[model samples]
Target: MLTIPSLHAALAMAVAVAMFTAFASNRFRVEIISLMTIGAIALLLYLFPLPGTNPKDGLALAFGGFGHTALITICALMVMGRGLVVTGALEPAARALGSIWRINNSLGLLVTLLLAMFASMVVNDTPVLVLLIPIMVSLAHGGAMPASKTLIPLNAAILIGGMATTIGTSTNLLVVSIAADLGMAELPIFHFTPIVLMAAVICLPYIWLVMPRLLPDNSPEAGHEPRKFIATMRVGTESSWLEQRIDEFREKLPEGFSFLREPQTLQPGQRLAAFATADDLREAGRKLGAVTAPRWLIKRLSQDSAKAGEDLVEAEMAISADSRLVGRTLQTAGIEGVAVLGVAQAPSRGFAAPREMSAEARLAEGDILLTMGRESSLQEFAQDQALLMLDGARPLPRRRKALIAVAIMGAAVLLASLGIMPIAITSLAGAVAMFVTGCVHFDKVGRALSAKVIVLVAASIAIGRLIGDSGAATWMGASLALGMQYLIPPVVLALIMLFVTLLTNFASNATAAAVGTPIAFALAEQLGLQVEPLVLAVLFGCNLCYATPIAYQTNMLIMAEGDYKFNDYMKTGIPLVVLMIVSLSVILSITYGL
Candidate 1:
């Protein structure tokens, strides 16, 4: 009804508010956010009665993001990553890296972080980190490091590596293409690699040294707990302490020492045993007052099992939070018949040990454990334990197809990086090749598209498009320019990049690039500076989602495996974000002559 300038302003604000709401609220699944952003903007634009475009037209326009190329690309990349994981292309690499971890705890963590970062720069970071997440989790349980120490640092390194190449992350390419459209020269595939590499190097010490220390170890089942064994206690028919209450045992033998079993059953001189793997068996007999098959019996079982052509491969699991099995022991659960091969804790150097009775070294929530079995048997053990499976101990599928999967991935990257094909097509085609050539199965392509990430990327894309089409980007650019134009041009670009990186973490990189790119371009035009630094800022910004766990899919993955809190991410990520802003600014200013 209104032909006023304020009508345009009101429409733009509506679109911005919808997007901002999607980002700030974690209530809705990310996929729904995409549809909501698109729908809300379309409705606002149409209802406001803008002079040139009718509401009906604006309605379809805002809703078009569901079919956008950015949405397709995110889905395709996710599929390809899933294929690589299920087919086990990264397992060999994970094993090779895992051995280094066994060398020592701190060094092992450093290696894992470095490898995750490096692998991401060369291949895709998501799949690589996915492969490593499980392995790091298993290692944490076995070596005594807290899963929290390893997981966030691991994800941060992957993000840093993903920033190194255009093909490293889908968002990197999205930024490159958007910048090209904004009238910058075409970016070569490796155009930003050196800058990213340098920044990553400078950030390495923080990742290795300070991150783990500042990060709290919540998973007490790891090595830090003073109670090293989770044991079972049985009452004897003729024992002195048979009728003693739970409270009496609780008070005996050291503070923090706890015993777990049915009340009134734990008696003095009764047979009692604990469950601990080779890693944590140190306190098994002495502290827990428990026995493990009388030593001679275990030797006999080991020899007999070894002669059967089956040395048990250890598969590790982390206890689920609020699990029912937290206070139970292997023997009481009939660990032998139920097929529990062994048990162990996650490892952390500075983490404190729990003060409970090592014999009743009962499982608490978030305990990492080592279970031994044949690969096939271990899978069954993982399921039965209701434990979360971590990586490096899985069986590979159809090794014959490994070469085929590798080829398809390589060819697609070649085509896309060389500008011979669009990224979505390249990735989708690669996924098809993996299936047709038997690299993956037909019934399970959906595994590649984690519902959480697909929705997040799609919603962010819709929001980005709405922001662009509703003139929101232009208005925001003008506002941002008022304070930024007089500042050092490089700093402007860096701050903008950091802001986009935050958005990218919550939504998707494509959203950050597509939306932030235009704003950066418009802002650069207003400032009379070269557009390279501004565009580079958008590219760099889309990868900086280190502050929160939900900022990225890789972060979610580590949530179950690492037993980490949201604050763990903030402690480690905040400084890194600050470091990246300064590093990227200095590098961009020097390279692009800002």
Candidate 2:
């Protein structure tokens, strides 16, 4: 049992975390909280001297997770996944999922969830979900269902299925190994699969139906072009948002520069729609309002025939100009397509540049300065600025690079699965191939690393090790068995598994495995139960990541993509989590002699 001081420490950490988390929605702030938790654990373990070790030793224990193989493995896996998407290796899979969307949005989500679950059962869940992220996004786009709804559910499904077999996730193997160390026979590869499948069945309906309703769609206004406003911009000697597709440069325009219009496919010299005078446009620009259209104005123009209506004015933003975009980077522009967000580069060999920044090359003269705004406003900006609008976009690579990207990932999987190398080595090798083969490239790798995720995983792992190293976990098990001491060993094993599942919702799956596995072993020893069932409990508990995004990388991966606020996960996931706890507990109890 954890003595008074350890309990006090744990409670202190809990209160500190709860307060911080209440207001930690800002991405950078959340990361700080995660770092602080890790630091606090280290400080207390060393300073206060938890039961087993001095404060410094505890600090060492917490910090040790920074060097754990699991963290490195996950980071590498993320890089490999990024490579798959950037190189088009995952396009075929995305296309397949897209076809499902063609059937219907709901059915498509259902199929994606089931497919993801089964796919993880066979392939590793991490890579499988990586390939599925883009697919889910595309499916949402294609079916007119916000991606925010589909990604989380799919991620949850994969995590659930990761428990189906000993080899499904590395945590399963870790639990099995720990159990074996305690003299229990290693679980067979498919030993607890039936129980997992039962849990999967109970979980799938909630993921498909309830989750979509709860998740928020952050990008609802994305495709919906803002109200077209009349504005003018004195295109500076070199402004970039001009003549770029409204969508292309939307992100680069200044804030409050929305109310953009689509192109009408007018000739360069054609008189575009006139909504307001040049003076009005300039007046609007002074307030940091709309800019000229980034892309050809034609793309943003609506052609609704329902009421024989071609256009209507709506009130959203005042006029703006390219001045706000002159020296800004795409990341800083934050425009949402009411007006052009950035400047379009001058046309070059066989293609026209958009109104935003390019990583490829620097600026040159006579490039059509693409400005963004409402149809008439963008025209005024171009006329006043002496800029020419371009024809169309040929900016990004359109050809599929699927074969090469998939081949690289496949090679790594083959190498690792066949025992030619360890998972980390093979995964790292694949990441290297992605950069070397022009799959993801070097600059983008950092974006994929995502510091928030790295810190969170490290902290969770540290807590798991602490729980295991301390006698806290052992006491928990011993206490549970005291009242049910007369139950059969198998029944006791199943109950222990269920308890582990409860612990997982608060602490992440990985930590649950690390801490709960050892405790399960201790319980087996005390109760004279077969260790295999306890090992199965550890794996099952670890895989139940449905209740929160912080527990699994896939959960976080889906968070932004799903447009989910925190409460959304709790409302939808709590029921499914509870269902798994009950059903899996009962199933394992019956099947394994509980």
Estimate the TM-score of every prediction.
0.69, 0.60
Which lDDT values do the candidates have, in the order given?
A: 0.66, 0.58
**Cα displacement (Å) at residue 40, model 1:** 1.2
Q: Which window of 10 residues has the lowest lDDT sum in candidate 2?
A: 305-314
RMSD of each: 12.8, 13.8
lDDT accuracy of residue 342 in candidate 1: 38
Model 1 per-residue lDDT tens digits across residues 1-594:
213325565566565556555665777766676666666666666677455777787766566645666557666666666666665677667766656676688888787887788778646677887677667766665564777777788888898888888667767766765566446887766678899988888998998888888877767643443224454433334433456664655443333233443345555456544443333342223333443333444455445543553333445577776555677864455454123433444442256675454433566667666554455555665667677877746332444456677778778878877889876789778877777775666655766666655555555555555556556677777788888868997778777977787776665555667688888877877788877778888888878888888677677778777677777777788899999988888988998877
RMSD (Cα, Å) of model 1:
12.8
Best of the candidates, TM-score: 1
lDDT of 2 at 22: 33
Task: Give the alpha carbon lDDT tens digit for every residue of 12-119 in model 2.
Answer: 445334523432333445457667777877776666676656667777777876777666766776676666555445445555666567768787777777777776
